[model samples]
Target chain A: MSDLNNMTAAESAATKAAVMNQVPGPEIEGQSPLHHADLASLAKQGPKTSGVHLRELKLLGHLTLRCNPANADQLAAVERVLGVALPLQPLTSSENGNYSIRWMSPDEWLILVPGLETFDIETKFRDEMPGHYSLVNSSGGSTVLELSGENVVELLKKATPIDLHAKSFPVGKVVSTLLAKSTATIRRTGDQRFELVIRRSFSDYIWLWIQDASLEFGLVVEA
Target chain B: MLHIYCPHCGEYREEEEFHCAGQAHIARPLEPEACSDQEWGEYLFFRKNPRGLHHELWVHAAGCRKFFNMTRDTQSYEIKEVYKIGEQPSVVAE
Candidate 1:
């Protein structure tokens, strides 16, 4: 693994350029330009490294599943297919390898898998799980960005009103909450890192918000 | 400028998402045999125009379309509590 801390500013810029060049996402056509801030400069500046680390989690497979948790057979089928049990313990997650499942609501969940494995997982669920469940292939509809380092929790509070105290949101917890003008499913990935699941339509807006919020602290954007 | 909490969405949404249902917690007279005309008159006419911390009913019309209760400070327009229609408030009105 690359030594993120050892990377020079020039190297950081190069990595960002490469990533942006490689995975140039389709431009959102009708997105009204943000009035209060410059989104492009914000996305370019990324997160402050000293207090917050931001990385664009590009090309991951995101799927939204809505199903009746009370249906034993169906729930079991999902478990068998995902290898990780659906976190039925409200506002929790179950991770297996690089994949994780977040309980979005009583009947909904947000599943994150490696970019390459997204399609396969969706296929498996379609073939295996049964009943009145709706699985939407939101892989192209949204993206994940990892926010780590110190002050992440404080940054989150600035964006949302949800009680994010450690007692309320411990590790292995996931919550779909309002982030500024948009919505995000925030999952605690580590002691300092959080994985934000944001929709494509509002990705730019949230990215801009993160940059402004992390300005006082140094921001480090990783590929 | 109403802040309404959606039970299904779990977000305190803008007033655009909710519709007010006026007074709540009014118990209907079970039987005519047990109630006087004055009691019925009081029940129908005596609405609590509380100055503060009033429990009002609202429907998440644009969201889950579910009815819920909101304990609000009428003077400042600050919501103190939001609960499902059948559930009790966690904190009592001050």
Candidate 2:
């Protein structure tokens, strides 16, 4: 942990919150949460057609923003950077192009963007937004899994207690809940599609859980 | 398993998402320095163990990570209401 507390007054004042480029250079390949699972090989060798399709949206930039939703300036700053307003409604999401924002709580929102665009967005938020707020780059801490197909909901139902019925858990709704034995921030992308943002440490456990749950309905690995 | 309503998430989640945090509305003595040893001991150890209509604290661990109060019936295992922290509960034991 780098301490800003030891810095000189001028240096401290000049410094913005620490933002690093987590994405590795071309020479070094970035590993997805399930990289060790070697899904790429499975995609080529495993069954091509199955009731469930699993894909990892690997190495995306994940930023956790904590600020006052009621503040007009902060909201406008977010809109200016992402070209989409913060989703004020509970359990809702706002998306523009490759950038998507999930309402994590009343005052917290998780923003996902292109891996390379993280620092730029963080800098923009620091320069544009005013008052007390925190923007944390958690890109390395988590990864996303895209689950789709006919039996996707059924597979999720086996692990989580939340109702997967379309009437109850509609599209664009996000919920932070327990998936199997691990925690995940789940969002409904479409009628039969769901996006799971899960911790990197628990990724392997979730992968095993999903594979076990999807065995009844054949699993198709998508790179 | 009990299904708890998280006021922060505005949804009813499984008991796995929550953890019971003992009794609610137990205010600490403001002037701890002025209190005697017996008074401090009473403040630390004394808690009501009622049979019905108890106000207890709970945390939505997996969902919102917010602490809230739940008015529950100990005998029936029924939740009367869920409210956020710092808010008063509507249901009371008479």
Candidate 3:
């Protein structure tokens, strides 16, 4: 647990919002949501070639921002922090270097940054951003899985009801919808590649579901 | 499965993405103290079970998580129109 009581009065006032380093030092190994499954070992022993390739982009900073898109100051503040403006268009994502912002709703956006930069970004937002808004760090609550390969779209179609056609769901599009029995924020990174942001608790179920669904197509675990 | 349009998301998502929240436009009595037992009972328990065109409240649970109104045909299961929560239904029961 983090030391909330040990924080000084000035530090407490400055960081009214909670911010903590989720990743430990080099001595302590950090585990992803699917750590128990040992996908890295499976990647070493599993088939070299498969129709579906799965890789977990573990420990990224997941921040949920809720503010009026129409607010010019809020937009300017975000651009200053991320070096990129928020993607105001619905279902779109804007990326600059390691920071990517996906429009979750008219008033909400999900921003992803390097894990180590989480606290710094939060502090900057609190210090600079203006108006009634919310910035929530949800990195511990979810993890991102990058899926790509020949049959990747086929596997996703079996799980979700959304149309996976490239014409309809172009690259860079994001959607919060059902993936198998659980929910995932699915984003198309390429014609056959997708990035799924799923809950930590449901990660195991989704992994199992993907394995079962990919049996016919064959699954390749990537480190 | 029924495909419902989410006005907020401005796209048609699957029915699984949404949860039906029963009848829409049911306003609570402004003066509860002035109402009798029958009025209170009607307000709390009674709801219309219309078979034709019906107005419904639904939440886009998996999508935007915003609540909206859907004017649907209960018989044919056809969604006539979908609007935001505060907006009026363009399609109504005739």
Candidate 4:
């Protein structure tokens, strides 16, 4: 029981790294759609480069918690269990180094932490968070695609109807919107780097769509 | 596309999740003798079709299924603001 609650940072990180290594990383074998564009030259052209930072965010812990934000006791219990309070403000997130929580809805949120922390977070939530709340483990259900080239925002606007303007969606903003036939929790990680959370079932289709959309720009699959 | 903010869900969803309901904030006259014919006609039939920014009511059919108001730009399809029923448009109200 004590072993479950207390884990060294290094030990947890190493375990997480091992788990990620085992999971079949992004299938780099297949040719990406925008393979022909010259990324080196496009980088000089600016943010429009295709396949700018296509990284497969693997083995990251993803959990879904649904509860009433009006319930102050439940919110406090969740904070105590995770050692980080859930971000109640809509579309906002609070991260404590390894753990980050995204406000998904008035009664729902997505909590992300190191991959190995998945079970621990779940156990803690189950033990602490009370009332009519649900915690679902969705790590295997979805994966992340980081789109960072200059043209990435333009490419996303083409795929989704949502406005991707800097004024509307500044850095640190997260949105769960439609991506072609699938759903994506799009997050702006940096100035040019945008992270997309896509479900596993529709990954192949969206991947194909992304490749096709970014054809004019170069698509580079990072190792 | 219109961004409809759901009061229950507390997030602005795509227009696909919403269905337009035209104008809101309407009230029915309590007594027939209390209002004139012109006031009754205006209440029953009048609607604003502004060319630029317009206040329109929408229902979150796919999400919380609640009715809400959205202020949208007619030309650019940009949603300026979204608020609940009985509440003023925050963007245009400001």
Candidate 5:
């Protein structure tokens, strides 16, 4: 029954922002937006081989960090917290094992960590980060979808207007752009693979979009 | 559709990804209390609708979400140049 200010540190009473653990107890269940889609059943029954493969990497920690890129202290503090330097270059991403950082804008980034580590990371940022910065735990707001296979590029091209050519968009490049009418933060993970960070509310729409668009190339559902 | 360059992203994205915020470089009056009604009215509602070169504020809404200044030809719909927010446009009306 922890309310809003339950997690504020006593040492820095006046200036600290309250951080809350959004995850519930073991008795409760935390279901992703696509939990009702029954992806597990689709994985088992869907085609084994297809031109495009879709998998929902659901329930991950989605943190939006807003800080000054010119601040050296903030950068070091972030590196200390995430163990990876914030990707300053526009339309780029950096990965440290399970943790991934996407450059959303000049002063903003979207970080994805493991599902259970959102609160831990948020608290760590609060303690270590300096100056004026904001770290919001937006895990429930969005979900990740990993798209791969031979025709993954084709499928994505149909949705987004960004140039998909390898010369223009290499591996690790991230672009927060419009995807099929909805918005998605698209990151290139591999030559044939891309990870799309989509809003939870638009998850069903994107899922339906993928299903409809990939029909020409064939789609395989992976759990 | 127009292909607009986002100075922040350092790339040219489709015009669909951006939104024209309106006229740029509209400095707010420093001393509003010591101003005439006509001056205040002009500052609040007046805007230039030039036929040729126009300086407009545009936002990369779907991309990096950064706002920049764009110098474009109003009649031809040709974007002359794009620059960052704090920087002034190199190509201006003659």
Candidate 6:
């Protein structure tokens, strides 16, 4: 096996892996995980204001980047591509406009970008990144949801066991925890707004769960 | 459910998010082919079921998904300390 620690730039460049553009052309329209849920119609027909508000962020790029944190060169390459340093702090997240990076673990980060920019970002990582690393595009595997309003906390408390107080989960904090019975990578985007990155398979279950939980508080679906 | 601290996430999460992966620090034989049947069976099947303080491997399945070593008192069900992988537990069984 080649020594990853001492690999020269030329050696790293030669070890390029095949990367495919998963995003299709404009002719082939993409669909969000909850497309079947018909949220757009509900946004218009549903109550204008309620205790809890739910919106599907929909069709964003989800990339999982795994690299060595100890390797300064690898870290620099990531900064060059993303234009922001990786949030090495545990449970922290950093964002640059449409691009948001969440610290998933010590050596792993989940990068979210606009749907159309997914392929471009992946290509940038391939050309810029060096040494032993893995960047996987999983946009098709999951979807995003934005929940807010006065009773958002009350609705979330019934589903997840995580402490949602401002003291523990302040803004810009990200935690991958159980959302109801399924897993969700939740980020506190605002004081009241939270972004949940949930699996595509569990989207139906969670949608129903959220609807049921928000019943007492009142549910407002937005497009 | 137990309140377990995930060393990677640096926070306490409910026990449902974690899974106890049996004993910790089980070293595989350097030369498995050289070992006899009795030695191989002992290495594979035998485990230490200590009554007091125990070192256990646990994975934060629903959170950061990282494995860490947890020192716990099996009788009292108290987690003494949670440390990252590759680090020796300070509270070893006496």
Best by TM-score: 6
In terms of lDDT, the poorest run of 10 residues in model 4 chain B is B59-68
Give one digit per residue, the lDDT tens place, for model 2 in A69-150.
8878678878998999999988889899999999998899999998878878887776777656778999999999999999
Model 1 chain B: lowest-lDDT 10 consecutive positions: B59-68
Calculate DockQ per candidate and list them.
0.09, 0.79, 0.74, 0.13, 0.87, 0.91
Ranking of models by TM-score:
6, 5, 2, 3, 1, 4
lDDT (C-alpha, whole model) for all candidates:
0.71, 0.88, 0.89, 0.69, 0.90, 0.90
How well does candidate 6 score on lDDT at residue A150? 91
With a 3 Å backbone cut-off (N, CA, C), the pairs that clash in candidate 1 are A47-A219, A48-A218, A48-A219, A49-A218, A49-A219
Q: Which stretches of candidate 2 lie over 4 Å from their true place?
A: A1-15, A24-27
| Model 4 agreement with the true structure over A154-183: per-residue lDDT tens digits | 778888766788887788777776788467
Give the top-scoring candidate (DockQ). 6
lDDT tens readout by residue for model 1, B1-94 = 7766677656555675567787777788889568888998988888888788788889755334568788888899988888876788775664
Q: Is candidate 2 or candidate 3 better by DockQ?
A: 2
Which sequence of candidate numbers ranks them by lDDT, best first? 6, 5, 3, 2, 1, 4
List the candidate numbers ranked by DockQ, top first. 6, 5, 2, 3, 4, 1
Candidate 1: tens digits of C-alpha lDDT, residues A13-116: 34432111222334533222232344446656664347887777766767788877887766787788788788887678898887888887667788888765
- Model 3, range A1-223, lDDT digits (tens) per residue? 4353343334444656666656675578778899999989999999989899999999898999997788787789789989999988888898999999987888899999988788889888877676567789999999999999999999999999999998879999999999997999999989899999999999999999999999999999999
Q: Which whole-number lDDT from 0 to 100 does residue A197 have in model 4?
A: 79
Candidate 5 C-alpha lDDT tens digits along A1-223: 4332223333322356777888875468688899999998999998999999999998888999998898787899889999999999999999899999999999999999987888888888888776667789999899999999999999999999989999998999999999998999999999999999999999999999999999999999999
Candidate 3: stretches off by over 4 Å: A1-15, A24-27
Per-residue CA lDDT of model 5 for B9-63, tens digit only, reads 9988999999999999999999998889999999999999999999999999998
DockQ of 3: 0.74
> Model 1: runs farther than 4 Å from truth?
A1-49, B1-94
- Full-model lDDT, candidate 1: 0.71
Candidate 3 chain A, poorest ten consecutive residues by summed lDDT = A4-13
Report clash pairs, candidate 4.
A47-A150, A47-A151, A48-A150, A48-A151, A50-A218
TM-score of chain B of 3: 0.96
Clash pairs detected, candidate 6: none
